[model samples]
Target: MFGRTKTSGKTSTTAAATTDHEVREGAKGRPTPKRREAEQRNRRPLGSPARAAAVRPGASKEEKKAAREAERKVFAEERALQRQALVTGDERYLPVRDKGVAKRFTRDYVDARRNAGELFIPVAMVILLSSLIPVAVVVRASLVALYALVLWVIVDSFLLRRKLNRITVDRFGDKATGCATYGMMRALQIRRTRLPKPQVKRGEFPV
Candidate 1:
C-alpha cells in the first residue's frame, strides 16, 4: 500500500494545473459577454449634433464699422430722448458750490497767529542787531537767520497748517471741489516733504 500511494503535494500541483488550463480554454472560447456589454454602454450618444460653425472668424472692417455706426445711432436716440425729458421736466438739479471761504480765512488767521508767536521774537532780534552792527556782518547774519526761518515756515506749513486745512476743507467744502483741491495740495506737500537730510550725525565717534 505504501509503494502504490502518490505524495499529497504532487497531487495538489497537478489539480491546480488542470484548473488553470480549463479557465484559459473558457476565456478563449467566448470573449466575456459582460465586458462587451460594458464597452457598448460606454460609447458616446449619437443624438446630439456637432457644435455650430466657429462664429465665421472675426467680422470684416466694413461689417465692424457698420456695427459701430448702428450702436452709435441707438445711443444717440436714447440720449435725445433723455435730453427731451429733462428739458420738459420742471425740476432742475444744479450742483451747488462749497462755501469754505470763511473757514479757510479763519484757519489762515489762526495759523498766522501761531507762526508769528513762535517766529516774531527771533526775527525782531535779528532786525535790531543788524541795525546796530556793521552793515556787511549784519546783512550776512540776518540773511542766514532769515533763510533758516523760511525753511522752518515751509516745513511747519506742510506738516501742520496744510494738514489742518485739508481736514477743515473736507468737512466744510463741497465734495468735488474739496477733493480736487485737497489732492493738489497733498501732492504739493508730498513733494516738499521729501527734503534731503544732512549726512552727518551730531555726536558720532570718528571712524
Candidate 2:
C-alpha cells in the first residue's frame, strides 16, 4: 500500500487569507465614485427657451399692447425719415419714384424749361369751372380753349420727347427708349407737387 500524504487545514486557511489581503491592497488608494455626485458635476441643461420668450411671446394684454406700441414707434420713425428725405431730395434715400440718373436729368430738363404745362393744374381748374357756365358762347369758347391748350401741350411734349431722345442718345447711347416718356410725364406734373421735390431749381439743367 502507498504511504498516505499528511494534510493540514491551517495551510489551506493561510493561503486563502493571503489571497484576500492582496486584493484589498490593490483597491486601497482608489475609492469608487458615487453616481449622484458624478451626475451633478457633469449635468447638462436644455437650451434657451426662456430667453426666446422675451422676443416671441406677447399673449398677455399688457405685453400685446407694448409690442404694438413698439411696432408703431418704429413705423413712425421710418415714415418721418422717409418724408424728410423725400422733401430734401436726399439721393441716398430717394424713393423709386425718383431714382436713376436718367430720371434726374429728366427732372432737370423739365424744371429748366418755360413750359405751358407748369400752370396745368390751375389752368385745368379754371377751364373746367368755366365749362359749367350755362351761356352757350362761353361754354363753346372754354371748350375750344381747352382743346387748343391740350393741342399746344401735346405739340410741346412731342418736341420735348425729341429733344430728350437726342440728348440722351448723345450721352447714354442706346438707353433712351423710355426716358423721353418719363421726362414728358415729369414735365406735366405741377412743380410744387412733384415728389423727390425737384433737387434742381429752374435754370439748373444737368447734362
Candidate 3:
C-alpha cells in the first residue's frame, strides 16, 4: 500500500509538470493575445514616429524641425525639376495635356513657324488703345482692322489644323483627336511664352 501511494504521488507530480509546460507553451504561441496588448505592441513599434516622439522627448522638437526643413528642401527641388521639365520638355514631369508623342509632334510643328495668330494679342492691344482715341476716323479704322485680323487668324488656324490632321494620319495610321486644336492654341501663344518650351527651332520643320 505504501509503495502504491508513492507511485501515485510521482505520477501526479509528472502530470502537474506537463500541465505547467503546456501552459507556458500556450502563453508563448498557442492563443492570441488580448486586444489591448496587441494594439500597444502595434501602435508604437521601433523606428515609428510615435516611438521616436516618446523615447526622445528632449530632442524630439529639434528633430522634428530638422525633418520639416528636409521636407521643404525636397519639395523645393521637386518644384524646380517640374519647372525645368516645362522648359526642357521632360516627359516624366510634363503635365497630362503635354504628355504623348502626338502632343509633342503638334507642339514642334507649331513652334517651327512664325504664326500670324501670335500677332493677335499685340495688335488687339493697339486696337483697344486706338479705339479709346476721340478721333472718329481712327476708331473706325481700328474696328475695320480688328475685324480683318480676326478673320485672318481664323483662316490661318483652320489651315494649320488641316495640315496637322493630314500629317498625323500619314504618320500614325490615324489622326489624333484634338491635336489640331492643340497645335493652333500653341501657335497663338507668343513663342517665348509657350509651355513645354519649343523643342524645335524656328524653320526646323518636322518631317
Candidate 4:
C-alpha cells in the first residue's frame, strides 16, 4: 500500500498525510501477516459482504428444489388469501373476474331473482328416486316431469341471462363489460353456498 503507518516508526520515509493500520510499502515483495490478522482473514469468507450479496443462483438440484418449494409456499398463501376473500367478502383480495361495481350488482341481482335452474338438481334426484318405485305409470310420469323441468330450467336460464344483461347495461352503461354467464351460474347456486358470501339478501339487491 502507498500509505504511511498509523503509528510512525523512527525509520519511516512516507508523508505525514497517509496514516492507517497498513504498513507503507516503499518497495516490497509482501509483508508477512501478523498471527491475529492472518487468523481473522482466514475466518472471514472471501466475498464483499454476507448480507449484501445477491441471492445465490440455483446451482444444485437441492437449491432448485428449495426455490421451487419457496415458490409453492407463496402460491399456497395467495390461494388461501383468495379463498378467505371468497368466503369472507374481503374486497382487496378478490380476483379481478369477481371485482368492480358491475360484478357486485350482477351478483346481487342474480341472488334477488329466483331462477328455476337452482331447483333442477333436486327435482332430477326426486324424479330418479320416484322411478325406483314399482309402478310403470309412476315411472312414466317421473320421466315426463323430468323432461318438463329440464325445459323450464333452460327457459328460466335464458330469461335470467337476459335480465342480467339488461341490468348491467342500465346500471353500468354499454361501456361496461357483461358477465351474464357468471351471473347465471351464480343464480343456479343456493344463496347460502354462493361465494363472496352474498352481502345482500334475496329482496335487498344492490341494483
Candidate 5:
C-alpha cells in the first residue's frame, strides 16, 4: 500500500507541471517577446539617437529668403487690418487704453522723438566723414574711438553711477534717476564697437 500511494503522488505532480507549461505557451500566442520589444522601441523619445537621425536640417539660403518675403507680406496684411480696426474703433480688435497708460505712452514717444532728432545731425556728420575718407583710415580712427568709448563707459557706468546712487539716496531718498542713468551708461557700453587685435608671431612679443 505504501509504494502504490507514492507512485500515484508522483504522477499527479508531473500532471501539474505539464498544465503550468501549457499556460505559459498560451500567453506566448497573445503577446510575444518580439512584439513587446518593438513597442518599446517605437515609444522612444524624439531627441533619442534613432529619432534624431530621421530629422532633416533647415532650408537653404534661397528657401529662407523666400520664407522671409512671405512672412513680410503676411505682416503687411496684419498691419493693414490693425489700422482699419483702429480707425473704426472696433472693440473686438482694439484694446481699451487707460488714461495713465496713455500718458506714459505719449511721454515715451515724445522723449524718443526728441532724442532721435538730437542724434540726427551728429550721426549724419559722422556718416559723411566716413564716406569721404578711405576705408582703412576710417577703420583705424573708428578703432581708436571705440577704445576711448569703452574706457569712458567703464568709468562712468561703475564709478560715476555709484557716486550718483549715494547722492540720490542722501538727497532724494530715491534712486530711480540714478538707476536710469546707470542703465543708459550700460546701453552705451553695449552699443560700442569691438575691434580685432593684431596677432603676434610665435617668437615675437607685442610692443
Candidate 6:
C-alpha cells in the first residue's frame, strides 16, 4: 500500500521512490581507490632482470644473435627505403650527392633534353668492331663517325653548361657550385640508365 498521511489524500510519492540502496545523482558506481592502492597498481619493477638481460655484458648467445638480427633488419629496411627514395625523389632518404633544391632543378633540366653523349657507348662499340673487320673503308668511316660524335658531345656539353649557369643564376640569384658538372654528367648518361632516374619527361623542362 502507498504510504499516506492519515489526514491527507495525496500519496507519498517521494517516500515510495526512496530506497536504502539509492545512489546520489553524481556518485560513481564503485568506491574510489586509495592513493597507496593506485600507486601499487601502477608500480613497475625497477631494473628488472628480464628487461636488463639483453644489454648485460654476460647475455646469452641467443640474445646476442637476436640483437644482431634486429640490427640487420633495421639496416635492410633503411636501405630499401633509400632505394625507393632514389626513384621517387624523396628528400629524406636520398644520398648526400643527390640532395638539394638546386641539384633537383639541375636534374630536371638535364632530363628534359636529349644529349648526344648518350650515343658514345654504342658508337664506340661499332668503332671497335669495325677495327676488327680490317676493311679500309669500314675502319675509316667508323673513325670519322666517332670523331664527329665526340666533337658533338663536347659542343653539347659546353652549351649545356652555359645554359645551366644562366638558368641557375636567374632562378637562384646565384649559380650553384658544380651544378654544371653535375648536370653534364647526368646528361651524358643514357636516360633510362641514369641513377635517381630522370624525374621529368622529355620536353618537360623545369620552369
lDDT tens digits, residues 1-207, model 2?
A: 122222355666788887776677555545667998888666653323332332453467666567667666666776787898888866666766666677677777887886777666678789989999899998999999888888888888889989998897787766555788888887788888877677776787885
What tens-digit string does per-residue lDDT give for candidate 6 at 1-207?
Answer: 344464243335555445422655765667899999998777664343443444556779898677667666767887998999988989899888888888899999999888888878887888878877789988888888788889999999999999998887677765477788889998888888887888889999888
**Minimal lDDT window, size 10, model 6:** 45-54
Residue-level lDDT of model 1, residues 1-207, one tens digit each, is: 554455666687899986886787545654556977888666553311211111123666666566556666666766565554333321222112212443333323332334322454467577667756778877777778776766766675456545555655655565324433333233232221211111223333112
Candidate 6 wrong stretches, greater than 4 Å: 1-65, 173-175
Q: Provide the clash count, candidate 6.
A: 0
Give the per-residue lDDT digits (tens) of candidate 4, residues 113-142: 677877888889999999999999999999
lDDT of 5 by residue, 33-90 (tens): 5877888667644533423333324556666566556666666776676665544434
Question: Candidates 5 and 6: which is better by TM-score?
Answer: 6
For model 2, give the 10-residue run with minimal summed lDDT. 45-54
Candidate 3: how many backbone clashes?
Answer: 0
lDDT of 1: 0.46
Q: Each candidate's TM vs. the true structure?
A: 0.27, 0.58, 0.62, 0.64, 0.25, 0.65
**How many residue pairs clash per model?**
0, 0, 0, 0, 0, 0
Best by lDDT: 3
Error of 2 at 139 (Å): 2.3
Model 1 worst lDDT run, 10 consecutive residues: 47-56
Question: Higher-lDDT candidate among 2 and 4?
Answer: 4
Q: Which candidate model has the greater TM-score, 3 or 6?
A: 6
Give lDDT: candidate 6, residue 43. Answer: 65
Write the candidate numbers in order of decreasing TM-score: 6, 4, 3, 2, 1, 5
